[model samples]
Target: MKRRILVVDDQRHMANVIKFNLEKEDFEVILSHDGGDAIKKAFDCCPDLILLDIILPKKDGFQVLKEIRKKTITPVIIVTSQEDEEHKVQGLDLGADDYITKPFGIKELVARVKANLRRLEYLNLPKKSNIIASEDLVIDISKYEVKKDGQVINLTLREFELLKFLALRSEKVFSREQLLEEVWGYEHYGDIRTVDVTIRRLREKVENQSGKYKHILTKRGVGYYFRRI
Candidate 1:
């Protein structure tokens, strides 16, 4: 299984340098000198990992990162010189798996790459086991699909996991902090707004008909629950 990596940097020398090392390690490398090219190559190659630089000719890394996320959660490591706290937080908020600063050691970069890839593989496991049917909805984890009242509902990887977590324990209340830990899989300091955003997105998909469902019920000032109503 050859791992494909997209290397996006405006600096040709830097891109070539990273490509040289990654290729030596048996990774299939795709190079893009600008953000636009990176996005194009990513859709075509579906790389296993993306090494993105913040400054680019066509668009900046943040824009590229946001767009990349819209398409796929392929493990992205921000390989750039942006060392500000805001930048790092923004990257994490955009759902980046990890962020690395410039002047990184080869060993450190490889380690971060390995860690992020491991996370993505586990999180994106096929969703088509058996149909997990509640009273009014069904989720096929292995098939990576979901439905409510027999209508297919498209879900991003995170939305799928969040819904599955709640559905598994309908009526079991979970705090926002608990959800961030259990579902999001990030035990570190993270914004609770992330939970809010994902929930809003899920409701948009699952609760389209008159906006009523007993699946996800929010507990004011406490947490949320999935009631079997």
Candidate 2:
């Protein structure tokens, strides 16, 4: 089955360009020019992936992303013209799987799109041991679900993959670069900050308020590791 992708951009030209390229890669493309309509299409079309622009009429990409995340964990890749780190961080914090700055090469964008979809596909594959539990946290690998203290903890596809990778290794420490290669599945497409953002988000969802149970811990200057306790 050909994967469906929702491309949300205010610029019609840009949207069409992306659509044309993605279609050539055998993806079904759905275009939305504004945030409100994007949100509606996001659910109605049930896209396999989303290429969302930050600037849009009505609600904007962040709002659309927030609304989509409230119910679904679909992979979203922010397509923004802003070069600011703040915007990129905001998108990641709101559950975006990845982001690409504007004027990006069509090849690079295509590569990123394929990479995100690959991760999603890998995540859906069957696992030998479908469950991993430590203390109050339970990771259901087969179902792609995580629970903390019997309550469902919402995690983006990327965040869940990171948690699962580290959890499967228990106390093994991995550098940001190693995680980028292992979890993101790309050595050169993303930076180390992406790992940091994902780890921070994961910790927020699964950790306790008292900071007593730090499931994911930083090793000072090293990197990150999962503490089973």
Identify the candidate with maximal TM-score: 2
Encode model 2's per-residue lDDT on 1-229: one tens digit a residue: 9999999999999999999999999999999999999999999999999999999999999999999999899999999999989999999999999999998999999999999899988877777768888999999988888999999887889999899999999999999999999988888878788899998888889998887657899888899999987
TM-scores for the candidates: 0.65, 0.96
lDDT of 1 at 53: 85
Q: CA shift at 28, candidate 2, in angstroms?
A: 0.8
Candidate 1 shows a clash count of 9
- Candidate 1: where is the Cα deviation over 4 Å? 7-31, 51-55, 59-116, 123-128, 209-213
Q: Give the local distance difference test score of model 2.
A: 0.92
Backbone clash pairs for candidate 1 read 127-140, 127-141, 127-142, 127-143, 128-141, 128-142, 128-143, 129-142, 171-226
Model 1, span 1-229: residue lDDT tens: 8788999988899889888988888888989999898889989988999998888988888899889888786767777687667776676556565567888777766666665566567756654366678666788766767888898876655677788788778788899899887775555534466577667767777764577755678988889887665
lDDT of each: 0.76, 0.92
Give the RMSD in angstroms, all C-alphas superposed, for model 2.
Answer: 1.2
Error of 1 at 81 (Å): 9.3
